[model samples]
Target chain A: MPDGGDPTALGFRPALETVIPLARAGPIMLRVGVNGYGTIGKRVADAVRAQPDMEVAGVAKTRPNFEAERAVAKDFPLYAAVEERADQFGEAGIDLAGMVEELVETADVMVDATPSGIGAENKSLYEEHDTPALYQGGEDEDLVDTSFNARANYADAAGADHVRVVSCNTTGLSRLVAPLEEEYGIEKVRATLVRRGGDPAQSGRGPINDILPNPRTLPSHHGPDVKTIFPDLAIDTLGLKVPATLMHTHSINVTLDSDATADAVRDLLRDESRLFVIPERLDIDGAGALKEFALDAGRPRGDLWENCIWGESITVEDDDLYLFQAIHQESDVVPENVDAIRAVTGSADAAESVATTDDALDMGF
Target chain B: MPDGGDPTALGFRPALETVIPLARAGPIMLRVGVNGYGTIGKRVADAVRAQPDMEVAGVAKTRPNFEAERAVAKDFPLYAAVEERADQFGEAGIDLAGMVEELVETADVMVDATPSGIGAENKSLYEEHDTPALYQGGEDEDLVDTSFNARANYADAAGADHVRVVSCNTTGLSRLVAPLEEEYGIEKVRATLVRRGGDPAQSGRGPINDILPNPRTLPSHHGPDVKTIFPDLAIDTLGLKVPATLMHTHSINVTLDSDATADAVRDLLRDESRLFVIPERLDIDGAGALKEFALDAGRPRGDLWENCIWGESITVEDDDLYLFQAIHQESDVVPENVDAIRAVTGSADAAESVATTDDALDMGF
Candidate 1:
């Protein structure tokens, strides 16, 4: 009887006006469908679910592997990425809602998590469904309307139909550069990326026992990618693939337009939501221990969502700012994906979305 | 008569001039005593013995510990660093040639390898013995006439009574900066030292789980130490203590007065005798793997004597050069100590001494 007073049970009592909760009636929960279900894809789905006003519509997978089983266990409705391979899910005992196309059409937004080149191919399908999609860093810039980094260019992505979250290294660099460019005005930037040989799950690739210049060229492609965000920002990046699999460490040196102290730069970066200036007390010095700390903290997949900057490593002399920072290769882009979803869908403004995402994920760990 | 024409051995006649072969002894082998039989001291003794123009006068130790045992195993005459402890060695059954004072008086030059502050205290002992000494990086620059990095300013140390081989970090930075400054004029330099919490053998130090800004100040002593070599070079340095103990990695950024390509910078570094540009095919990526490769390749203590610069990590854009390089804290300074001995004694000029030391040590590994 407490569920809602019935007028008939109250005899001649005047019919009471039924009131519906505004949260339940105001707007439909935004459904976000994720495709690919790989390293970036799996993280994106979890981040999407973390938003207060959003719900994961479903996740599409190519095969009914462990990840698919994981998706089911996490209670995410699974869909088939390839129609021809749909029966594989049933064989694996993972029930699918439908094909990837149905999920794409059903959701208000889709995050394309396919391998690098494959994102370009899936763009047409996103267009067909008229669903706004976010792409991962592996895809080229031209594949999307604009490359996205929550802290760097959130406003630029507002209402855009498709956005690409930059790579882990790019996200890491963008986060550092954004604060410098805004507060100090960057003159030019130079960064050397000590990249991981491969992600933890990637077993077959490597230089294994050797050191090689990846492109064997001056200024790797990363510089151009940074340019995509700050088109006028002068930057050059050198790449090295080390045997480590946990994270990518960056040696960054930036020349600001004007002089700034190392302390000032540290203070500026600390204010940004995505940059985690590692304090001297934590002793999270190298990538090995940093990853171990993450795992010990019970982070899902041991993800460190913020750029880990060595606090004491920030040194400024004259107009130069020098520092060492590590980027979690797998999960830095995860939070960016959440922010980009809001940016592309106009669900929230930059500040609100960034704050909400940062709060929900508990960044700066 | 292969044995001097002895009829009991063979019937061969010996020429009267055959006895003149002793004249080929050339220059008297410079007797170099290593005072402080710890990490750098022990290595310096071995390096001196390896030189065709030099020999280890003797090694001095403060304790009859494992290192003393190892010194004896290597057939090095051991002298007690502390006179009070001299009897302890005799009690421990370590046969000593004499006291540390006797070793200093016997040698033409002495290399002080004591702890940082103790090196400064040992200055009077060497001076009393009239033996010019080469100090390790631990001592203050004022403790010596000049700080020496063999590649940076070998000529400056020639005939100087006191020459301090710069610290492992400084030596590492100087090795990189010297080539860049010579090939292309350097307007300014910035470096970040990702320092080891302690050497591999230091069991008592560290946050173990924390990264600390060692001095918590801008422009660590490293920048000033660099100024000792390049007085006019403008530089700033930041220091961070990480958990790793194997080696210290440096993130170096230099602003050149002119332009240069990645290949050009790499070629210039490659030509230097002490700088080892890790080739692309070897896959020597991180400090961990680099150490492993060295150990697997049978390097003594798995020491990488040369600056381990990743070939592909060198990038030049406009007037800025950036790269990542690792300095094996233990042995990089070993070769420098040998060269410093030659410089202080005026035994050889820069090129000949560097070449001799490099060749003897089988450098560029």
Candidate 2:
């Protein structure tokens, strides 16, 4: 298989080896378990199945709904809550596991896609079984060992057992902010989160006809949320909710300590690999087309996984900077979860894992 | 009465004075004419009446609608379209010595709060009468000699005959970006605009359940739109729209050419008069409370009118920065409008005008 060479030679920090020690470990037949079959869990399971070295050991759903039936059809093992012993799975002729714990303990890595605070509860379950866990962005920043972004903080997750993916808003902000922070020292980060009311699967979300102010709280701790990845970093966030669902958009302003020109800053951002700086001349309309572009790029699950940055939005005078970017929360974090699995299991080098994952990605047309 | 000193001594730039001369030409009984009385116009009429230095010259509406009747109730010298009855004003005990053309010519200044493109057409009428005109934010950038912001560019409008107020998005960006640019060298500006589907009066505003990308246009030209005030700015913008109505939120990212710390940058921003740095402990909730805060601050309109910046969002690691803020477009621009009027007409000293305008704002409870 494509072990690709010495894991240590993969340009990763020395600490990563403890997590995934490279012995002649015959391609570890890792079992992947997903606790929640919501938007994120579904994507995670699908992605895991596509990996050459991993398998969707099984997945657990809270209810035996349409999604559960669909999972059953895939011939992947399915488990339903004991209380919901509804024979939906049996009717679908699929063997059903008794409980979520079965799926959790059976897997080498468990990804908890439960709603925000619920991830903390599953964190304990994953720990009890000594099964490593990957978490979604919704969980609080304090819950995990570190927040992982394959490109930005792959090494940070090395030798760690638990990782939390920052919220969709934070993921988008971190990706854009990291590049700028890397190239230019960031002084202040001011952002307005134009959040979507509900996911396609969710119907109860929204302010409906009214333009409501989400939490007027400043620095939403989102800047700090990103900091879980880059500690000792100072950042703040302000948030707002709007009626939209496909993607989250962020307007950002940064004040640098020293004066730099706009062109110079743009040059720095362009150098980052995962960030695709949209040129000023593209007549691209919105996130939809960008999503299509990502899909066309053959990203698995139609994920426009990279941050789509607009070029003209770069402005610099004195030492300040401003720009805008769109972040697809669903897919951006998907790739990270894959990387985390490798980190916790000590299966591959961070760089090698990232490269392989990038290659494995179906950059779909 | 608080002219303070030579109107020219007030840091007023000569470039701005060439367009709108100081009304210091002695309490000039400037005749005001309103062609369309929609949301903005109605507000303008109220604002004009609130001014001790200016008086209602005359008003005109499309027809006898409830709005028109409301304007009439304000005791505004109302005139029907000269097209409907060329002699109606004369017959209704109103002076018609000069026709609409002559009326426009007679006014010292005309404020056009018509819909977007309509303001540009009225320009010639104002010009024909040797009167300067103030256009609303909806008009395109190229339609006027200058775009005005009392705090940032009032001096730029000193002598211009025609001035445009930038779009609400532009106005918000400019206010926030200007101070950052001034205190810290601005490197680049990126913004995602979560725009409202409609104003409060429009019923078909939004269902806002789907997050759609507004325009994938870069630099949203908002930074450039702001540059109309400070022409030398190097700014770019990317814009996205979310279904919202209360106010527009922007997520801005700025990259500095050189390295600076986040704390240093935050300190610089805190000093700017136009920006209201939300203290870390205020516990304010969202745009709604911020609006109320602005109103309680006695802002003329219940919008923050200033950028509601979160201090915590300011982060610095090496050279990157991040931040979030909310801009109340409706009322934020109002103060700028008042200042622009003074700037164009040379009616008040820049310092005095700023102070008075600031004091007049009803920030709200």
Candidate 3:
């Protein structure tokens, strides 16, 4: 009946305090594998490479295409996500380092960035290899032990066998909500997601010429996925797919527990590393300028790693807080994946982990 | 106290019911003088032209520019908004029909599309001519007797000497709020405006590389502007300017009087002539595609004249409703302007005015 200091009882490996320092002393790098190198996966692999303590073990792809060539050009060890497609790389004159299973076996953690639903299929394989894994928002909630947003619940993932990095919209909602939930206490939250029709490379998907209510179901699954993070939080989310490939924009309204000024809310969010309170002067007015700013600022693949919030847009009327922020669909999760690696491996606590990830990735704008 | 039959005592002209029908028989049209040939002004002028019962007496411009030429090409008798700038038209090889004052004197009603403060400045000119005036949202609240949103309060403007068509944002907000207020009742409202940095042609303005909290003030002026229409409503708004000229996107959350479903809200909005509940299938996702859809759909100036609400984005949880919709900053108000003409002149009731304006402009897309 001992409740304290039992690593086995707590269900985690030797405490991160013991394990992380040892890995640091030996100069041994954590091998991180990225599966499904598409919009999210490619960015995750690059972000994994950015961390000083971790190295990308390899990247896995279902087919030997442009992304496969990209994986080779980046010098990332390429693995076949589908065993049957192993020869596609060799025939395409690309050499393969191994299959995804081998990558899972060799790496310390595998980030499942495969297309939605495919991650669920790959989960058994990661489990067979006893590899702690990270899944993107596209996957089901059951596939992960917890839905992760570094700022919201970084520590929750520590020693967890599987973690799902919430979708871009949820990650965005979580970042904004966490501050309110912690600093002001959220009474209820409602957000409408103006989602991009598809990733920039997703040409085949869309209501290309119209605005459609994606999922046609009330309170799109995004709300429930967010619930996975804050189980008691009352949230309702509605999603719309627009013919946009750049980023998703979220209109958030949070009813706080107490009345707070826009300035107070701004100050609170400003203090968070992941929430970039866009200065009034920068005038990053919309997703277009945000992307351009990212590209011009020389962000890798024009990535906006932090939420681009309109500082002037952060306003409070009575007890309600309203603001708009853009979420870069392709790269916002990259930093989270890096932080998740530390979380799952007992490498760092929340503050130390987030700070390291933020500093290494140059997150706060 | 003989208020029963006296139109003046009732604060409206019986001319709409009595004189209008007689004037129609005599081939006389309602002369609408558009003061200001900018983004809103030009569109209003054209919309006035489109009305079967009205004609553009003239369109006033500050300077002889390309817009003047466009006005000339459209054969709208162009007037000089600034008397001193009249010769500029001749110098630019564009002919001027008259000065703004003459247009005001000749027209039965003036639709003032002048820049924000300029509308106030021209209010005296309109008063001097004893002409009933309809001002755009840009003017100060006190400059007009009431703020008009056809769907929300069309009847309020009937026989009113002066009315200010609410801003693009306000007009859009009123359309959505009106339905909820009527069917379910709105307890409170919170909205974030993702506004266009400038109209497509106003290249001079913007946070060209950043998103800015436009107005940087809490509960942006838009809320009070909406209050100008619904004086008793409890609403709060936050505003952001994005670097896009196509349209303004609104993220709205309404705490209703009673609980409702997304389907109920969608059905309610669908019944509105001014609100275009973008279907779940067309996949019209963002300003870019919405604009493209408008252009491809062969709308003049690629204007999406109705509020583009994402159908699937309509969701209600508890007594709250959330949705994202785009307001074509340039033209959503165009149909509203036409409806306001009918409203102010007592030409139509709320439903009739809205329907006539919608049919005349091919609104409700």
Candidate 4:
């Protein structure tokens, strides 16, 4: 009876603990409204719907464009983001859920995806409805109480009124940094980001045939942005804008506080669900091939939600570590946006939320 | 008269050095035959024509196309690379300067810019004719006895049977490194190359919208290639391919042997004629803006022969140094090829050939 009760069976004193299903532990059907139903917003809405604890309350867009049409086709309630532009939807014969105000009022949390400065401008509207909001990376860091990367500083976001998910590049760096800092402790980090000039659909942004230093300066805004997450972490980032539209490839070097081997570092990165350590045998050369690989795998919209890190590139020289990783700018943050919802609402801890989000999105490859 | 040559007037022991006309110092009317007159070949032909000691013996093309037409229009003697395809030149109403064999036999040196491995295959022909040859960066490092960067190893190339001008990115790096290594003594270098997908006319090449790890591995060939010029130098390079075809931008980090201020470093880089320190007042944002600036400045073919280093980006933290520089892929190596001709001929020292090449091409911005 003592052995069956496990008190005697366990050699060490077993701590009494209960494991719960991660699915609905976070929330009970938390309604989420996503504004700016473009590349990221639509994906977030779909991801939110897939979460057992969350559901899409509605989506807001300025026009009844193709993306809005697709949102409607997905059975997502669509609302006009700009109240004055509501009639344009009716003129286009599109069904409407309500104005953005009603969507904000009904939602437990609002995810703002407005381009750049507009996210800050939309902050007041969310506050007026007393609905805590999540902002994308493009907005100014000062606008939010805290910048969130689930793996890096998830707890900092708990119950925060306005939390911003760092940009795709920042998110990728944060995820990589989190495990490295935890395992070995970091001395400093140096990263060079070769950024895509534009999204695939965006034809306007380009050098078309040239690489540009994004800021043509050292510690290009990214380092300061990363500091917003791990405020004390020493980092320097350089950026180059290239013609690529697929993903942002990062050349990363981290100086660890303690000596570590390449294999150990690879193992650590592999343990991270968000960091996909690309194996040698796969023979995936570049982003072009990576996208093709994604399409072949039948991923949604051919999206890669994880940082596709090359395994062999994870090399350690003394206490210094070096590797190359690609961040799918359009979609890496989609899952982060999902995790931010749980983080900002105090519904789930980092582990449960990351696991649940990964499970819901089929995150690991 | 006292100040001109007297050690007493100088107040210091003056090492006597001779000043001579840099022009025509390298070779006595050296005849140079250019092979594969495409993006690099045609530009080299133009640059060679501008050198006082050099003359274009002829140029060979596999096909009589637009570039061939441009070569012929520029009065560069044109020849058929493939004997079987000789009729193509005649069919295109282009006058032939005879077969590639005739050009190789007549010229003192053959500059082979044939696609990658093709340059190696053409190497034996140059040796057969007992003609010294200069190969472009695309050729394997083993193909050349010495890899030439006029500023770094001009003397090494002297009297060498074959020399390879390191690639555009490598040339830019070497030029930057030469001064740094000379002044501060370099401990190590880490460079990330954001490469263009293709040459401007090359519509076939692209991620078009994706960034890719060129090798998806550590120590991309660039570091090894740079080592070809600086054999003892420790360098680790990573490469990313982007949609831009205009140029390749490099994010550079060097751990110097000594601590230095950014101002002193800037002044040193400014003294190097091949390094164009882009002043902040220029307001050039990226490669696109840089190209427009080039055209406006009346640069021939808008060619940027110098490494365009952003002045403000240069920073020093402890012993670490960082900056960003852009390499105009199509034309940066043009002047290097010109210097290699002089170096191989044992005509000029590093200072002489570099100044000669710079003066001939109107190199500095």
Candidate 5:
């Protein structure tokens, strides 16, 4: 009934009525190939398998490791890189029909989770096979047809062959920035990124005992990197390194041309369905509690894969506005990756894909 | 002369006369007892020695190690805290007299760079000895008489015995927030902290490859922490952790009550002596280049160690404003620490110390 109307209402337009039913469309079949089965690739594969409409057709790993062996046990068709000996997978008792290139050719879509520079190369492999591929945030902004966020720019990737998910930092920044840009004409944007040195697995990170300026540069290009998504928008960025690692936090300042109260801005943000403005109440403890809540909610990832804005921090002064929000890079992009898969396949209506994705995310905090 | 008057032609009043030549402030002797020789403590010691008006009278390490031995070679008195064994400092070949309590009593000022929760315990020691001490940003804001910033509130530390330097994140936030707050009354503030899992040496920190929401709580009290410095401030903060070692960055949004052009705001910041707004020119590269420049400048600790604001990023539409700046925590606090030493010693005029400290900083893109 939240649809607010009967499909057979007398004044109903046929086109609108026809699309309404798409909301209940059954899941579509998807053949997904995952390359570079590291942290992100593995997660992507697991998430795809969870979606009723999608399935992991195959997966490719650079080397035969315990992780690769586990993927094989999961029955994911495994493939090794050509650079490695073809018999490597066979030696590990993991059968491979062919190389990673063959894996790319077999899937309807590919998800590239290689290291920064490697994603672009993997992207080319997908293109050579005439298969649409999704690239993670590690690649430079210029490599993709579009950097996709289901809520922000899902439609932009509707018919594109290549889509890049903005860097985790960019994804968070863009999600927060896009809404502001749409509601208020953004004149310029400023942000500072507190980044982690390395993951627990990457123990080689440094100056751990000391806090240092990661980039002595003023206005790190991260601001401009955001423009790859919203061209013609003006923005700038600054960055620093700290000794904590759950997410990248940003301190943003936005200058507006029109006078608006902080409350008005907060209201605008709250109105967005995809965005979650953390309530002033609840008083959830720390990032740890928030993560637990997300997990309890059965969110694809523990925290909001989408942008989570803090309600209390939202403020407005004359035309200037300030507020804080967090973005879960890993999960935020998952939904987008799902949508991108649907977009490439053209197997389901856009409206249906979005509705299904949103409904699935309803179980999330 | 830049003094704009004859050496004494200005018919100096008693207020204008000097008790001691600015150059002859007798190297305000400072015995720095660093209990935890970690990232922040090491930087503080290095910064203290770099100051012409300050010296490292003594230093201590929590445990014996190559780092501790290095401190000893630097002529720093080292100590061990193995229960009663720590008391051996008095008998050591070096001048390691007294317990941490005695060390606090001997030092004109003590910099508590211990981990969080430790600073609060050491407060009583400083109070008992009537010795002024500086605590790191990790301590609760209320613990110190004031949070000192050489450029923003150097004068507040004037006659106070205890001052707290805000955390690296807060320091960065304060640097950007102060300017905006002064120019326009802030109605509210929201920030996203893109925090790193760990520093280079801190490999044990984090969710590793996972990105998580920190302090799932709304209004991470970071804003309140900031208010410890500006009690009446209307601000709130949200935090996130990402898998990167670079620096923590913030994306800030501000809503203002009045209409102002972005140019007007940028001009105001550009004029501030302590702020180095990156000029539109110089095509300064990324964070790496900036870091290199800082080191090349012969900066005692390398990099600006200050808030480096970007020029072109300043933009305003109607009443909104936006800009970005980078804050080097370890070094940013160095200047403030140096100034605090002078204030506690009363060896130089407060105004002189403020001016010299401000001038001594290499504020630029």
Candidate 6:
């Protein structure tokens, strides 16, 4: 009777308002098992920990490594990715909660942040457990029923068994394209991607002193990746790889179906929680500066989940829109992975999931 | 009469394919005085040395520096910029050929590459010697009646008393716009300028690890500067300063008056002598890589005088055209400065001047 919260039955006058989530009542928390435990995986696990309705079931790693030790240190109940390598963790002085299969069976949903092609191989394992899996952008489109971007097509992933979150560039494009398409119809999108050469720890990758065309062709793979979210939208993407390892800078131009002023578009973008419209007062210059700002702001690993859109660069002339935005490749998709968990599990709607993920992860500048 | 080729008088014994000039008939070599022996001035002096019709009368510097010594090593006479401080060169153990007044009187035209506002102060000196001067882009638009971009407004500077070569960004834009305006016609232009922090040696100028909006406003000064060359062309630019010290990258979207295919635009831009449409096979990534490539190719100072326009980025959707081009801030304007010399002196037509400067500097990729 006390748990039912029937104030009238308790013989006490009911309060003027009843808080739906009474102090005693908590939201349903889902156990999300993170696979791969690398850049995307570890960040997503931490994000899940921040969410009110999500908790890290555990993290699965291939073998005993620094990440596995860090996972153990976080008390995340580390699991061995390979059953045969389970003894390796013990030898490395790391404790394993169980095998990855057990984590998969226990988790409400599995986030596969494994390297690109490995996710495809992990599919059968996910199917064996009958557990829904959310794969990262590196995975092929055919591996999942739909490619996911929280802003562009989050609902397309709701209640879905297999979902693929697009790459950083695609995610950035989708986030910008969503509101524009919603507020004012979009005709075509053309983006020039100045991508960073590699992640901070990548040693073999390069352009160390150069800028190379990612594909040196028209309509790079990024445009098709974006199409996965908005199937009918026409987008042409050209990519260039630069020496910097900071972030990807995109020069975007969207031809609108109707006329809109720069101010109007700025307002529309500002309203979006994920689009961090950089104000004029803040002197964020490029990806390097953005990272400094994020680190100073005490964001986890200085991960920026928002599209750092230069507010001043958003200009409109007739039906054309132009803007420059920088996307922190390593972390922008982390929140999307978190939101994708809620999406695939049907735990929340797009707004609810995004809001929850944003609040928990401290999204936006 | 022997110096002047007359086919009528020599017809009786003239060969069927007689050349315009005999081997002994030398061309008119103009004495070009270079004022200010810094970055642009030194390059110009070397370019003048390479030109068959031009010679460096002397280079003037306020104080004896390494550049002055270097100039003397090249067998070019050096002059003191500050007449009163002429003894400074003697004290520095750098011998001067003459004073500024003598250099100005001896030269036919002066190329003023002095610090920004200093060019305005030197104008009276050129007038006192009844000499025309070609000023660098740093000088105000009002400092000269015409601002010169060889491809865009070479004729406008013809025989003018004073002329200013547009800035690096403006020159890059002008070169790209020239052909587009002639073939497709432009409705309007919107550009995003990702500028370098400063020259390689300017220790104090920096974003070092930040991306700062140069002005954090719409319609940056660059757009108006471009208009100085093409008064009626509409352009809006947003400026950003990054930690880089190599080049300025511009994201451009032009609303063309007519429709054109991407291939056709690429072909047009490729045909331009000064626009190096980066070939996909070259694999040059950005400014840093470009410098490395140029150094490998044995270019002087690894200077890229051409506008590095990405061929793959050229896209067309109905009436809108989009592309990204990088301007080498240090050396792209060097050729333009050379052309401005011909412009103010009326030494050659636009094509002739451009060809002469290009051949002299070994320009283009």
The candidate that wins on lDDT is 4
Candidate 6 has a TM-score of 0.86
**What is the C-alpha lDDT profile of model 1 across B38-95, one tens digit per residue?**
8888888888899998888789889899999989999898988887877898888888
lDDT of 3 by residue, A217-256 (tens): 5577888878888899998776656556777877677889
Residue-level lDDT tens digits of model 3 in B12-91: 55445554576557745677898888888888888888877789888888898888899999999988888777787888
Worst lDDT run of 10 residues, candidate 3 chain B, spans B1-10
Report, for every candidate in turn, its global Cα lDDT versus the true structure.
Answer: 0.79, 0.65, 0.80, 0.85, 0.64, 0.80
In terms of TM-score, the best-performing candidate is 4
Residues A181-242, candidate 1, lDDT per residue (tens digit)? 88989988877676677887798876453333454455778989998988999987767554
Which of the two, 3 or 4, has more lDDT? Answer: 4
User: Which scores greater on TM-score, model 3 or model 4?
Assistant: 4
The two-chain DockQ for each candidate, comma-separated, is 0.11, 0.27, 0.19, 0.58, 0.13, 0.22
Q: Is the docking of candidate 3 incorrect, acceptable, medium or high quality?
A: incorrect
Evaluated against the true structure, the overall lDDT of model 6 is 0.80
Q: Kindly report the docking quality category of candidate 1.
A: incorrect
Candidate numbers, best DockQ first, in rank order: 4, 2, 6, 3, 5, 1
lDDT of 6 by residue, A222-298 (tens): 99999999999988777766556778887777889988999999999999998999886787667776787899999
lDDT of 2 at B90: 51
**TM per candidate:** 0.80, 0.73, 0.79, 0.87, 0.60, 0.86
Error of 6 at A272 (Å): 2.0
The window of 10 residues in a row where model 2 chain A has the poorest summed lDDT is A1-10
- Candidate 5 chain B weakest ten by summed lDDT: B11-20
Deviating ranges (above 4 Å) for candidate 5: A1-28, A81-84, A99-106, A117-119, A122-129, A140-144, A177-188, A199-222, A240-246, A252-304, A308-321, A358-363, B1-365
Model 5: TM-score for chain B: 0.80
Instruction: State which docking tier applies to candidate 2.
Output: acceptable
* lDDT tens per residue, model 2, A1-365: 11112434655433244324433355655678888887888787887888877888888876667778778788768777444564666766656866777777677678888778888877777766666678888887678778887766777666555788676667777767676766676876666566666665577886554333455434565767777776766665656666666676666667786777878877887876566677866655456667666667666556776676777666764555766677776777776788778876677777888776666764322
